[model samples]
Target: MALNTIIINTTTTTTTNNNNNKEDKELNSITHFFCAMKQQSPRRRRAALTTFFNTMPYTIDESQVLVMSSLWSMAMTNPTNPELPFSGALHCMSLLINKSLSQPSWLLLHQNIYIPYYAAHIIGSYTIKSSSLAELAVDAGAVPLLLELLRGRLSWVEQRVAARALGHLASYDSTFHAVALHGEEVINLAMKISTSCLKTVYTEFILSEDRKKYHCDLLTRGLGGKEMEDRKAEEWASQLQCWSLYLLSCFAFKDKGCHYLICRELGFLRELCRMWGGMVNGESPAGVGLMRILCRSSVGREAMAGCPEVVLSLCNLSRSSDDWQYMGIDCLVLLLKDLKTRIKVMNMALDCLVDLVELKNLGTRYNVGSTITKALLMDYHDHDKINSVVYRLWELKVERKRREGMMVEEELVKRWSLGEAKKKEGNERFYSGEIEEALLLYTQALELCPLKRRKERMIMYSNRAQCCLLLQDADKAVSDATRALCLSSPANSHCKSLWRRSQAYDMKGMAKESLMDCIMFVNLLVGENREKKKRKVIKVPYYAARMINKQMNAVGLFAGVVTGEGINMQTIEEEEEEGRRRRRWIKEG
Candidate 1:
């Protein structure tokens, strides 16, 4: 189904230490309120959050909110560029949502704010008042995108946010009927994550009202008279926080929420098996056992004790690659942490590690071994398996690390010996007047040295370049000099190497190539933003370097913006809800 894009007139700003100003400080002050609420319990957190929203600082301005909204939009769409402002906005949402079991309500709030925003973002641009003031997301292609996200638990943050957003859509209508992506393809692709096939509480919500949040800067605050995208983002975020906290409430208090989740969302676990594709055992038609138990449990638990099955299931597909295994592991880890469900998924990780070792893929074994080692070290007080698995994990990790360290040490020793021999050979070749042979020997020696000897390598690279120049190997000469320039640490060494290479390339009738290399030398390594004229015979090309400066600057800015969004968007729901409530009341009045 197509979702309507709601263009809000909200405003916000973030302060990067490097980009600090008066405005940044004030914006941070406003966000600090949310940050403080992060420490509160579910009930107190909500109360504190509500109080904070009610007593919002009067100095808050519209332009600031607009900026923040633009930043968020940029981050979401700027997945490629990375500088887009809202890029790490999900992190903000996670902070608001991923609370302790004690704060289930706040967690629900966190879930709602980001999920709806994600749904809306997928909606694309909208038309309002016959004048498109801003672009709002639509739901034209969100299903496929969300399915893709579920295919691998950790493919893309944007996609993960979108998938989680589906749950919120289901909740928005207060029905919890739609088990999103409960279809065959989505289920089969997702290793651990599941979607329900039959009627669930969210099913009603998904198919219910299709109301568009029509936000305008000039309009009154309400459904149609929604606040500006920039202004109300934080408020809408607050509303989402409320919903997520509510959902989280389903998990705590020793209730049957866990088992009911599996049963109420009928065929969810089955779809998970189906989505696992090649990894599935294909036994018993995907959760025939789960079906009977879930049906029995959901019906029986509420009437009986009410405590749900707190344990979840996990898989370990040893034949799969790191990416594939990571998908499953991430889901398990997340479920364990967020759902307060203890699952016996560590067996899968152990199986994967054991298989990795058995396959004799040293690199992969080392990688998996390292991963389990970290897991073993993590605080395991909550998990029962850690008692049985920790020692084994430690034993394996020690063995792998020992072997790896030995291998590294042996390689270094071998390189050192080889380098010594090569250096001797180079001296002999140089004394014999065989410059080409001498250069080859030097190159061999340089390649054998450790990173600590990078300065020596730079010198050798320079000499090789000189030899190549004499031999009329302009390409080789340029390559050697360019590499040397890159490795050269001292200011004088870089200046000389870059100058030599630039001149040598020009002499070889390769001005364009030389220009490109010279440009890279300055911009990437030397960072030659300015130059002072001197009586030197040669100089690095300043114009070429200048040409790429904007691109690099843009990349740096985008990175900063993305990182900031990650930091600021932790409680996206709280911000959004706070905005929505104020707007709604104004509209009603």
Candidate 2:
């Protein structure tokens, strides 16, 4: 009997006959059709199954679940077979879309775990091939059933299919309520699966999610306990993680989904950090892509500040050569937009920017630009996101130079303030003859100092050198003095650092080194005096005459220099006179 004939009788004879008897007859008819379907050959079955669904009744009465359940069982039993009635079942659901019948179909599919798995298989295989059908299936309430399939300890195959299907559904429309409802769960599952799969294959080290983070600890740490299981298990777990990440990434693309992701319970953001912490794992791209999506929103970016390692993980990935650098920059740019919100975040961003610029200068200064710079130049179309970040970092660097006397940028000033307080305490200790204590304070100041405050850092280093000289550690004094001199700009180079290094060299009996440093120090002071006089004479173009003035100062300073067994270093009185003259010139000018 045709499915419609049985459906007509079941609806019409509801009171004439017992409802159970009518449902049984309708189920038997559906059963007979399925049995006949199994008997047909592969080509016959495909055509017969297609025709059977096309002719089936669209109405889903209360007793319709019995027939739908039977069809779901048949599909599950022959899940891998290409000749099965997969398309028939999907077509039946598609016809039920947006009708009172659709909810019943989904209810039956969700009644048992097996049905959801079956539905996911059909979706993963068929719906993915057709957008209209995928949308149709989702509209017919496939998402809830698919999400149900993801729950619990289902087989890897079932979970993979469910995740893939949901990914397709979510990708089609990110703002789907289904995506937002379970976005956090999906992120957690993806992170859990990704970490598990990574450990199974590599088993190198167990990662710690503690906030007491060490620099590059994620990269260097090792996990060395159990040997990995079979490669097949690893492969299956990897696929599950990958699909789950893809699904979660789809969820992250929308504002509500992104908000749910970062603010979820059990630290979903921390899990993301752990997944992206080490070397580029299999889930890195998906993880980075999700981060990129989250960065598109202020709520998402604000939530990210709670996970401190997120910034560190991004910094680590930015140093890598993979495409993750692109996503990492996207994330960092968003975080840097409002630096006043989180001091720790601002510090981490500054650290990353400095590392990126320094990394680009590793081989040669001018040959290759930094990773962030290259991305900004080559991917300018993405400028609103990428270039703004790179430009802001460069602008900060330039501002750092301009504000040599006074710390600029509120965040930089905040960092410098703490360092300056420590330096002041160190200065007091040094004046009171607490040489060792003063050295300790100076070292602590260096830790608190911002990298952008080059002048302040140089002063701290020079202070430590003075203490080192008092402690009779000539080598340490020389090291500190040289660092201060190198850190200083050409225009504001610290003559005291050069004089201290000269003293250290004299104590070490290196007469030539002492003479050279003393001569350089004297020239630096004398050149400043000459610059003052020249400024009074006429406003000279400094850039045009810079090299010429440097040469002239070199010639004048060396004429008084004599390298011998006895080195005549500049006296303290001479240094005081030079300082007083410079101060007087400043007041006179």
Candidate 3:
């Protein structure tokens, strides 16, 4: 019988009077659907199944035992009828995959490809919401059939739904064992699919100009052309990888042995860290979700700690604004909580963790950023150790800024020009003896400058340091100079900022620090002169040489011994006066 005849028969049997309630009509449709399934005609049964599958709600009630059993039989058993003995959905799926090279006609392709996908989908959907339903599906032998599809007996399209069904089945304690019986094969296949599904889909469907008619129709749902096919291909590809990871996570969460298998394949973990799933499906956790599951095990944490690339990828993800950003942080925290892994991965994670210290509004945990920072740092009793990590973080941040500055986007260029104009005005004000006004202009310019303009921002910071120095704010001067030095391409290589910080440290009576900065400043001056003169001979600037000599004398190893206790007030006053004279002389020259 034709499909239309079957549909007409179903409508005739299920038709209700206008007075009938919606519940009555739905009940009638269910009754007629089962009646159609019992018919000997293959076309009638197939048509009825398609209609029922399409209209079924996501939540299947317990009262629908017969409906669930029928779907499982269709999915798992070869048809007993001699007319179509090989026409069971799973059997046909395998046959179609095996004989796909012969290039079947469009109708055969559509039936074979779509029936298996829908049968697996219905099984998964009904089981996902209730463990009882999942148990029933497991008893009906859904795992082996689903496993066939997952093994790529068909294309990635079928593997997508197969993985989803198996994941749902594996999630329940009652049904997990059935799935775990083939745990090794299941995990290995899931990992393989997750790692290569994207490329597989692209090669089979999206990249093929002469795509099969059924594939194009299925991808676009017969509504569009190549563009729609491409869109659907990417979406399905993402689903394939995500659902595969979801399956692996089920095993990794329940079994420790699974963690060893998963983490042992470090390449897969690295791939997982890069699967952000947002481009195709925003809500899918992709690889980060799996990484979080793996982090829950000691074996997994050690494996991740051993792979630098995977740890680096997590660090990158934690610092991003991606939706799974917290999961990345969670994984890192788990690793850090382990003493053995902490020592190995702490340095790489420090930069990202330090950046997150000020993060806010992270999914209802408003203070999580600061809380995590405090907890991580609590292990370090020595303040110096904490300071050293923070110092290294600053250097990493500055290098990142310098690298980003090389891009020079259009909007940033405009902002940088505005900052330059402000800096020019500040210089004019300072030359005119309007020291306070110059200070304010430089502050505004610093705010206006884009973070990407590292070189320009370095100059702004150095100028602010000078203003702070003359305003008698020694601490602020040191801070600004340090920022300027960090922003320099090679840290501590900015001559002016080094000299200004040296002066600020000298004012604070930090003789050792002051002496170090003065020597660095003198060395930079000599290097610059050698570069300009193109000569082997070195000649430091007169001002730098003088500053270096003063610092050397002030910080002499025997100075305190000779004076019986450091320089006296009059000598300090003379040094300050000479500093002022030296500054004026350099400016005049």
Best-fitting candidate, scored by TM-score: 3
Order of candidates by lDDT, top first? 3, 2, 1
Residue 294's C-alpha lDDT in candidate 1? 36
Which model is ahead, 2 or 3, in terms of lDDT? Answer: 3
lDDT of 1 by residue, 1-589 (tens): 1222222211122333335676576666556455544655656655554444333322333333333344345444543332111222323222222221234343244223233233334222121111111111112233444444444322222333444444333333221223233433322232122222111112222222532232222122343322243223323322222222222222211234444333222223323222221111212212222222332332322211112222122232222221243333333333323222223334333433332221212223234333534443555455555555455444444653465456667787777678868878887887788988998898888767653455766777777777777777866676567556545543223554655576575666433334434553555343443334333344435654553343334222122233442112122233455435533533353
RMSD of 2: 25.8
Candidate 2, 1-589: lDDT as tens digits: 6999999887888766777787787676556457557754767767766666665544333444455556555544554444433446664544433232235445444223233344465556555545655555665566666665566343444566678777776776532555556666665565455434443322322232321111122112223222222223334445666677777776666445455434442244554553431121344475667776776765566666656767866764543333345567557756665443345565566544443442322212231224444433333354354435545555544444455536557767776788899999999999999999999999998877876566888899899999999999987787677657646664225788877877786687544345456656666766776787865334333432443344334322111122211112332233455445433543353
- Residue-level error in angstroms, candidate 3, position 99: 14
Give each model's whole-structure lDDT: 0.38, 0.55, 0.69
Model 1, residue 198: distance off in Å is 36
lDDT of 3 by residue, 181-219 (tens): 999999989988886676667667766777876567667
- Number of backbone collisions per candidate: 84, 3, 0
lDDT of 2 at 577: 54
The model with the greater lDDT, 1 or 2, is 2
Clashing pairs in 3: none
